[model samples]
Target: MQPTILAALAFLVFGVTVGSVKIVNQGNEALVERLGRYNRKLRPGLNLIVPLMENVVLEESLKERVLDTEPQEAITQDSLAVLVDAVIYWRILELERTFYAVEDIETALKNLVLTALRSQIGMMKLEETYASRGQINQALLQQLDGATATWGVKVTRVEVQQITPSRAMLESLEAQRAAENKRKADVSEAEGTVESIQRIAKALKEQPNSQTVLQYLLAQRYVEANLSLGQSANSKVIFMNPKDLTEGIADFIGGDEPNGGGDGEGPKPT
Candidate 1:
């Protein structure tokens, strides 16, 4: 009977020793609550706690984590709708505040990020939103860092992933871009034509039989223009008399008051 009681006592002591030992893995932390109240935190490695009275209420990794938010619909200042998404890199600086200050850190962070993203986008035009992604990311980081400081979470980096316009908006933008390109091309072509005419007029003024040469060149240009219109499927062909066109071109190219003439007097017949 005496030997059995000693064995039972030894077994009880072994059980208590095993129960008191707590091994915390690296990069992890645990919060201990004594008798259902806050007590202390356990860092990596072995720790001890009163088995029945103390409890590990929380255990979390201290390493940095990534949170990716889904694309959210946002309206630009121009009333255009776009889908925006982002990625947030963060880590806990004070586990206690992180646990107590916010009900769910990740959820709160996501909502905060999205709210800031929308607000920033709301103040910008559609074109500006696409061009100012860096500005947006910086603004978001600042805003988040300030806001989450109380929660004991450090926002390390923020990245704006995608900003996409809706299908209808994309099509409209493409059409606008094409129209702008066409307008630029037309202006360039018009300038080239004017320059060519100026050069030809200057050259003709220096040559004998200038009037005949100008008339021939004007007729040739008119014929080529007509041929181009005839070849185009969408051209609205306008048939103009060649004589009138030539006369107009000659008057424009050579129209200048005769030397020593009054303003009321026109050019003398060449």
Candidate 2:
């Protein structure tokens, strides 16, 4: 009977020693609640507590954590829709407040980030959103850091990952850009045609026989046109009369010379 009592006492002592010891790893913290109330915090390494009364309610890493949010649809100031997503880097500063202040820290932080992102995007045009990534990130960091301060969270960095437009919006932008380019091309071609006509008229007025000079230019243009058609791989060449091209030039040059009217007639008295 004596030997059996000694063995029972040894087992009890061993059980108490094991239950009182708590081992916490590096870069981690644990909160202890005594009898279902606030008690104390346990840092990294071995800690001692009352075996049954004190409970380790929370134990989490204090290191930086990353939160990557899903892509969210938002509207710009110009009323264009865009898909925006981001990455956040943050960590807990005070474990006590972090555990008690917010019921769900991660969910609350994510919602705050989404709200702030939409607000910032809503204030800028779609074009500005594409060009202002750094500005957006900095603004988010400032807003989130301040907002989460009470929750014992420190937002270290924020990054806007991607801002993408819908397929329809992309197509519309392409069409707009193409129309602008075509307009510029048309203006340039019209200007070139005007300059060429002015130069041709000036040269013809200086010639003694403007009709002959105009005829020669018409013939040259006809030859060049035929040559271009012959060089084209897919062209079906068709011959045109050079004389038909000369009539338009003839009318253009017939009016007057630099010195006087080509008809050698003075102005008639009314």
Candidate 3:
């Protein structure tokens, strides 16, 4: 054969051989349309098709994909506005229906997600949204899956990325939290103080000569109060009554009681 004719034949054969087979990679699927109508689905690996009579209508990945949605604003049941955003995880469940069942799957999905988010948020209060993220995510997954089932899509999960309130509302929430914590701390400290006082009273009742110990404790507390006055934010250096301040200290030092019990070295009755 002539060299030019042989080369032409070889080129034609190679083109036809390459066009006859379609390579569908792993984690992917392809849909074949025959005579401009629905046909069979090709899964991962090599697939054969009639090159002249048919073509691949759609190709999609079977692997899970992520969609990061833009931030959306929604009102809570409390009529509070919050900015919400989410991430969606999805996969193509059926290749044939994925192409035929929906015109624009992604747009449909985006809208579906946004609507679901708004609806869910509207059913909850603003304060509940922060703690109920898992509930919101689960609700989104269920709603998305149900809506997209006909489209042959599976919504694996949804994650609420951010749910932020207005700066004023956020500051108010933080202040409320701090106030609640301080109230709880004050109550706890008061309860502890009461408990300690009760314990000390019981000990004093059990001892026959606990007056001297009580005087010493009172003097110590007086000294501590004097020392801490400078540390108090709202404290002023007001002159306190000298008589009231010296009452316990005189008893703690060697001053005799009215009953002349100046010798505080006696063994206490336990």
Candidate 4:
């Protein structure tokens, strides 16, 4: 063969060889089509195809990916508008179906999620929506997985990141929570007071010096009741005569003592 002819043939052979090989990276896939018809899938690593006959129509990742959905306003069963944002975990399962069956996978997956979310939220009240995040996530996962099955996508997980009520609704919820807490506190305080009264009554019935103890307890409570009055920076204290206090104490205990010197008639004026 002539040297120039040999060089031209060698170059053509090199071009043909180069065009026949396809290398797909790890965690990736490619779809091949032959003359406008589905041929086969090109998996990860080196693949061979007929030069000028087969074409790689699409390349897609096989690894799991996250899809963050934009916040969407959805109405609850109670007619409250809630803004919801979510994340979807998914990946392509079949490259051929992914490329041919779904026109736009991301857009489709997101829209499907939004629709399913709205539908689920619509069936529940605002409180239920807030409280049922796990249920909502599971519901979304199930719906998305089922719907995307035909599109060659596998939805592994779904998460509801945020569910925000409107300003007025939020304020109402806060008020409701506060009122509930207050009611609980009041009930607890009332229970404690009742328990204290019962214990005191039992002690009085069982003890021989109950009357004297009761009188002392009453006096102590009276002092404590007025203790807050003396906490102010400008608080004033009035001195009462000890003689009058002694008389009052006797009167309060219904005693005229000397041996019962103080008359038990009534309290003496301070």
My TM-score estimates for the predictions, one after another, are 0.64, 0.69, 0.59, 0.62
Better of 2 and 3 by lDDT: 2
The candidates, ranked best first by lDDT, are 1, 2, 4, 3
lDDT of each residue in 98-181, candidate 2, tens digit only: 999999999898899989999999999998999999999999999998999999989999999999997777898899999999
**What lDDT score belongs to each candidate, Candidate 1 first?**
0.89, 0.89, 0.83, 0.84
lDDT of 4 by residue, 52-136 (tens): 9998888878999999999999999999888898999999888788888978999999999999999999999988987899999
Q: For model 2, which pairs clash?
A: none
Candidate 2 Cα deviation (angstroms), residue 193: 1.7
* Model 1, span 1-270: residue lDDT tens: 999999999999999899888889999999999998889999999999998899998999999999999999999999998999999999999998999899999999999999999999999998899899999999999999999999999999999999999778889889999999999999999999999878897987676666688779878988899988899888898798987776666666565622212354755899
Which stretches of model 3 miss by more than 4 angstroms?
Answer: 1-10, 167-270
TM-score of model 4 vs. true structure? 0.62
For candidate 3, what is the lDDT? 0.83
Task: Tell me model 4's lDDT, rounded to 2 decimals.
Answer: 0.84
